[model samples]
Target: MMAISVTQHAHLLASRALGWLHTHRERGALPPGCTAELAEPDTVYKPLGETGLAASLVLREAVAGSTELRLARELLDFGWKQLGGGSMLHERLLRYPMMSDPLETYAHYARCGYRHEPLELLLRHTTSLHSTRAAEVLPNRRLAVANAARISGFDRGEDGDEGPRTGSTGGTDWAGLTAATWLGALPEPWLIDWLTAYSMTHTVFHITDWGRLPERLPDDIVRHVGRWLPVWIDIWAEIGEWDLVAELLIVDNCLPEPLGDAAVWERLAGIQHEDGLMPRDGHPVTGDDQERFAAHHHSTVVAAVAGTLAVSRTLGTR
Candidate 1:
């Protein structure tokens, strides 16, 4: 299919995914794996903390842009109510000390225009994580904290070092973060597992603002990711891991010079179901409605976001 057709197909899938999510909600059906036996409060936190699936679905709504404004608003409303007025992150942090997923998820809501005291306070809390949390956290988490800080207008000083001066006197520890992450010293791109590869993609996208702020990334790091991305994309696509494949597509668009592989785009478009339910992998979901939605939700959402981001970037450039 042509580029415009590809864009249209993505929107169609996004619409279907949103419709499916809402239809399930109207029936009082919890997402798959969400247990109804949990007590009142557990009901909210359980789904929130489970496997990152719900949060991914919530983000897909934000990424849908103006096309799903009404649905997006409804989803965000449900999210706030479910998370106990959005203090779940704060509560989780008080308990877990140095978790990274909460920070990332909180940042997603913040990015979606849901700014409030809870999120703002968490962004401030990230400052402490730089020292106490940085050593133990992965490279992707470090980038995540920085991105959250930037988005929330929380500066980590001009040096970008929350701790003492560890790197060169003036600049942020760009070099240090790269050295810490998988992408910085890209191993055999074909050999890394899917999750690790996806994490690398996240690191690159967040650190470089999805390639819009390419200068923030080191020249060698940028070249390194761009060089091996096609191989990684092809391998994952052939395996029919649509979630990771869609993520790789986002990564492709985020490269300074995007790969923009028409054939790969075609493959992704071909796999999307008529109702926009992109299977998480080669295997199909085999369960009840809620179970099936839970299994397939993350990949379907990823496909929507990947398509939206690619189309938006394409439109911006044109």
Candidate 2:
């Protein structure tokens, strides 16, 4: 049989995966737990919380301007409708947590040209969290907040100094965060477990634009991550950590140049079901529809986003 190129297969997988998501949207799709709560015909409610919604929206942006733009648009519409008063986005804003997800979600939508009053409110809401809740924000989340601010065209001060203050407390120290998060104290990338490693990767991606803008990451940190990325990818892929592997694919793309690991891409593409569900990890779960969807949705969403991004990069070079 003739082999399909990684880009072509990615396109195929993305198309099929998105189709599966759409087909199953009301059934087993939309995170099984949220299906009932999210069944409201007019809006997409993320019962699982902002992360799934964030990933779905990011997937939309990844596929934007491509042949899959229809799916992208559909998701955008669903998400936009959910931003009204008392919606998931709104509720998250009122709580005033230090998490950066709501900011990143809106920023991704903004990058796709869907700006509106509610999104701005969300951004403003996140900006406020910098000062009002500085102590609660962790280093990785601080990077997310900064990136969201950058992408949304909101100034986060020299280091979010403009945020509200709590007496003697200060804002998130951007320089200090950079100094502490990567390399200097953390274990080698290969030695770290998956989730923490993912956070570190996220720190790099947010700060450095996935290596596209290396200046975002210090020279030492960039060199460090770039040097060890291959080993990380090999290790994760061998263990069938499809989600991490796909994320590593993104990390590879953010490098100074594409890493061009067609084999790794193909291995990721190979494991995808014909219907396009990529299991979150090596072990496949079997059960009721909701149970199964909950187990696999995040990884499937990551695959779609990753595939779309890989295709975009491949085409950009060609």
lDDT string, candidate 1, 1-318, tens digits: 456665665556556655555554433323455432333433334333321323343354344565465665566566655555556666655565555545555555565566668656654655544453445667887776666555445534444434332221233455676678887775676678867987888887777655446566777776877888788887887887888988888777666666567677767777877666778888866898767766776676567566656665555541
Clashing pairs in model 2, backbone N/Cα/C closer than 3 A: 210-254, 211-254
lDDT of each: 0.61, 0.60
For lDDT, the strongest prediction is: 1
Q: Can you give the TM-score per candidate against the true fold?
A: 0.77, 0.75
Best candidate per TM-score, number?
Answer: 1
Looking at candidate 1, what is the lDDT of residue 243? 86
Q: Clashing residue pairs in candidate 1, if any?
A: none
- Which digits, one per residue and each the tens of the lDDT, describe model 2 over residues 207-294? 7543335455566765777788889889988888888887787776666555667788777778888877778788966888767676
What range of 10 consecutive residues in model 1 has the weakest lDDT sum? 161-170
Q: Report the poorest 10 consecutive residues by lDDT, candidate 2.
A: 41-50
Residue 122, candidate 1: alpha-carbon lDDT:
56
